[model samples]
Target: MSTLTVILLSIISLMYSCKDNNTAQSEDIKEIKSSEATTQLSPNTTTTKDTISIDKSTKTNTFTSSPLDLLKQNEKAIVTLFQEASPSVVFITTSVYQRDYWSRNVYEIPRGTGSGFIWDEDGHVVTNYHVIKDASKAEITLSDHSTWQAELVGVAKEKDIAVLKIDAPKEKLKAIKKGSSNNLIVGQFVMAIGNPYGLDHTLTTGVISALGREIQSQARIPIRDIIQTDAAINPGNSGGPLLNSSGELIGVNSAIYSPSGASSGIGFAIPVDVVKWVVNDILKYGEVRRPVIGVSMVAENYTKGFGIEKGALISSIFPDSPASKSGLQGMTNSRLGDVIVSLDDKEIKNNTDLILALEKYKPGDKVKLTVLRNNKEMEIDLTLGSSN
Candidate 1:
């Protein structure tokens, strides 16, 4: 209990006091973080720092949301897009008149109803070709309830898209804000705005269910890179706008993979890229000029092995086709044919490879094709042909 002992005791007390202060500061920081976390704004809800209310009606307590909140915050953006695009969207109805064979009387039948959007102020409206198939008359009803008789401008059966024109005021045209479908990602929020079941301007929310979906159009040809969504799309929703969170038109609601004729939560849309291509062609050439190879072939199964064994077996090549000129052998034995093994330098695994490769070129573009003939690989160059 001398001066040195007293000084040592004082140092121990100061150390203990500092440790306690540090512990208190740590607890305060933790408390602040917890408060901040809870105070985060819920999406689609108008929550402020001064007044935060949790609605038990729409949201459950177990669901602490981050992306959900983001979706809610984007609800305004979805609504605005729908509202702005709604005016440009039109409800298309078709009428077919047929004569009753037994009664010898002609009757007007309501063919169908679908949705479409204004392409430009020139009165052109774009929609699904199936929406007006074999109809004797077509009509378009705007968001303002104004109805006009529409004339078919052009139709692209391959893309299942059609363009029509109506004699309406230029000022009434409201084209949707176009967006890139390539930028879409799976699980991102999307909204479908259309006339579902003839109910005009209906809005449904969903997320991108998948990408690069391939579906057969009304013409029974494969349409590629279709956007798949869980949005509640129905019969009348065809040709309507499928919008992104920013309210831009990313796709055109085209088909549904439902057996019930109603929404099974699986809907397909024509990607904006295809729509853009169709639109540009319809506006310029009044038709889609698809490229063709002018050759018929069967899909050769290749799971067993490679070589002439299986690939795209040439069935019949047109007399003046590029394939015929390139010396690509066709099936003369009715069962066996030369198999396409590669294009340029890329290996062709199946017919899909050849299909995808041809998409990159137009008519008259020469492409190198490697073929397997008599168990030996051979090369040939063929110029593409126009499907027109």
Candidate 2:
């Protein structure tokens, strides 16, 4: 072959080899791209060679925030809840129409002014029973400067709760968010929204001082499980809502344990549980069906060292009474008294324990009682009788 022909033939073979290598590299790159796309599409199918994972050792980090940061974050929410709930809280003033003793004519006298909250869209307002006691006329003033004559729907003296209805427009009614009092604890944040001393829509904040407190209503009935707060509650704050931070009504501001008729940093509220029970019974039956076990007993102190040092000393059991039928052993000679020690496996420290145990059960229910008679412990079952 000639020199020019050999050089041309060598160049053609080199060009063919370079083209083949390029084609193979392109195919390999395309396959790799396709495999990457598949892996991206199905991430679950992608697994690591090692099955066990170890903890990643990363640099420690700390977060620091200002005290006002939390307040700034929640201020708007808190304001919104207060503004929405304030309208539901109404100011109530009562007037009583009494006939002159000598004239025998009718005249109206202002009783008192207090706070209340709309219970429903039906214009039913709930307030302290003492607020409207002896009042023949009640005026309910809404947040919008609208007024309506209210009629008493129901009253629960024991709970110091009363329900009143106003013939107002449904659009004006704002019901409060009901909260559970069973979950309340000491030192939790509480807010009181009410018309204090006739100032409308006032908000006071404090912590729950205590729980399960006992107080006396104006009607002389003992209210149990009352919520104690130090939220600057005053005279006009009665019947107003004691709300949680979430703006849920936990209690009704009822009484303050102070020498002066002002906020002495100790205020009591009726728990929402009692309010619920009273309201439900009043709305359904027009009266409170208070369950009581009809039996009167002497105090253990009066019969000290007479075989009835503790527990309730059964003094008398009426004929055909539930106690009589339940075979509760009483003093047969009217001199030796049997001491009750426990009920339903619950130890009875004194008469208070017996009363507490009985309060937990309704009439017509059976309770097991453990008694101390002649220095011996004995158990007996007794059916509770109705108070009525």
Candidate 3:
């Protein structure tokens, strides 16, 4: 072992060690590339993706997907849903007549725009009553951009539901698949399909914020059993379908609790259960066919007044009406009226309660009404009839 020989031996050992280190680094690089090939970003996050690996040729880091595609599953499901449901959703435009100030000529002007859904293969479109309210003419535009004149079929203003018939071909019409809202739970995934702000076939996704909600319609009637969601429902989204994850129609987008008429994360919808009955009745009888007691009740919430804390008072009975035929007396100018206490043994606390109870029955159904008249309680048996 001379000095030169020893130095040569040490250099050879160092070379071997360097070779081993280089091989290890090469293996590590291969493993890193393999891991990158199989990596999947989180679905819940939409943040910007960091630079993954630098390319020696390009001298810059390359990214695989956009921040938007982080939630690929949710996005794919929404896209599929829109494809299936968008055809069922239709755009609605209403027109009203107005007299010009200068020309004094009556002209039909576009009143408002809204959204609706096809109810059946017969081309019955369902929308909010206010959407076509006071409109002398209306037009429905399908997803394929074909416009058709709509004929008014039936309407339930209290429920804010209106059915319009279009003579669209069956091949062009797609009826929405109905789902029951009776089993909905809060926080479940929901999607809204509509034309919001005149945007056609817009899809907004959210969770069910609440259920069994109540809302007032333009006709001053309380629409009960509403479904509330955070989906972005705006001005033109009215009467559109609110769907569950299965692309089933759960509710109809009716109103929003926004200050600026924009989506403030609070939107209301009429449940499908109510729409089911309302539409069925409309198809059968051309209207809701709700039984009328044929007694005039004071307007402006008279049933909730201080004089009569509860019970719907009979203001006046129409001649040849069920009440008139049953010899029911109405209130006069100087005295009080017959306050309806109960119907069919159901407790009627106020006029709204009476209306709701009556909604459970149809025209020509026999019902017993217990009334408080002249400080005495009496039962009156009357066969329900149409209000005409």
Candidate 4:
């Protein structure tokens, strides 16, 4: 054989050997890929080399929720209070009748909404006077979602309080327990339950921010001895109860001092002490039965015109009454009469002050009055008379 022929034979053998090695590498790669694909396709499959194993019994879809801790002492107390006192709270809705100009048909339109509470088992409901003011009809809804038509019983416009009667069963009516507001102190915790924004039975917690605060009623009368709180009182919270820690009503949530018409922490309530008498008088007389001093005081504007800026100026006295018998003089064409400066040592600043002062007493109750006559201060003793 020739040398060139021997070299050609060697090159062909090398090419065949290289092709066999490439085929072996491709088969090995296919086997390795098949194993990996099987591992991914079957999550339950296990491999000792990579040490990857998934238990079929283990569930990643099911969630195990953690337990919640128990409530704290104060939190539990508030919860209990809300549970007990909420039954007495009620939701109030008012409507006004409007006649369409074209159709000449009358229809009841929703006027507003507010909060209220049961006053007695006979279905007497208590709320703010402004809540039902100008309303032709009112309705009361109990905590159980039962609603009833409410009749207007009476209203103390000066105090911004009103009373309504419902025909609900005595079993459904839960009257709130009364608490004294005179003993309330600032920083004392209080809770307010109301239907804010038409949401029924909403609760808010806060403290009494101040005592003896004054607020004006819808009648433009100054409501004195008011309780100021930091509770979140809104427009619908008017007529709701302000309860103390014991779940007794200490005041009636009435107003908020906010420019945005929402709660800005400063809220006012009508003191329960004043509410007690006002409600009682309404139940009996259909109006507040305030004591009469048998004397007419000059309006604040007129008093200011006379240069009397800080006291109630007496305009006239009724004959054979408390003022006349006590020799309380009134304004004369010649000179000024007595300007009441104080009542029972309480300073009187205007006619409203004197009127509110007189409300603190009853008929035949003796009171001492300090008056300014001829620029000289003198004291007078008189017995109050009945307005009736």
RMSD of each: 12.9, 12.9, 9.0, 11.3
Per-residue CA lDDT of candidate 1, range 1-388, in tens?
Answer: 8999999999999999999999999999998986766656454345555876766565535466699788987676776767776787889999999999999999999999999998788899889999998999999999889999999889988789999999998877787778898778999999888898889999899999999999887776678999999999998999898988777888889999888888999999999987987888788887876566667777455434434444677767888877778777776754456788887788877666676567667778888888887777888888888766
In Å, residue 179's CA in model 1 sits off its true spot by: 1.2
Better of 3 and 4 by TM-score: 4
Looking at candidate 1, the ten consecutive residues that score lowest on lDDT are 301-310
After TM-score superposition, the amount by which residue 74's alpha carbon in candidate 3 deviates from its true location, in angstroms, is 3.8
Prediction 3 TM-score vs. true: 0.77
Q: Pick the candidate with the highest TM-score.
A: 4
Query: Whole-model Cα lDDT per candidate?
Result: 0.83, 0.81, 0.89, 0.92
Candidate 2 local lDDT, 240-265, one digit each (tens): 99999888899999999989888999
Please provide TM-scores, in order, for all candidate models, with all chains considered together. 0.72, 0.71, 0.77, 0.79
The TM-score of predicted model 1 comes to: 0.72
- Please, what are the lDDT tens digits per residue for candidate 4 over residues 1-388? 8999999999999999999999999999999997877756466555665675667775555354344323465688999999999999999999999999999999999999999999999999999999999999999999999999999999999999999999988999899999998789999999999999999999999999999888998888889889999999998999999999999999999999999999999999999999999999999999988888888878787777788879988889898888999999987889887999999999999888888888878988999999999899999998898876
The residue ranges of model 4 lying beyond 4 angstroms of the native Cα positions read 1-71
Tell me the deviation in Å of residue 346 in model 1.
Answer: 5.2
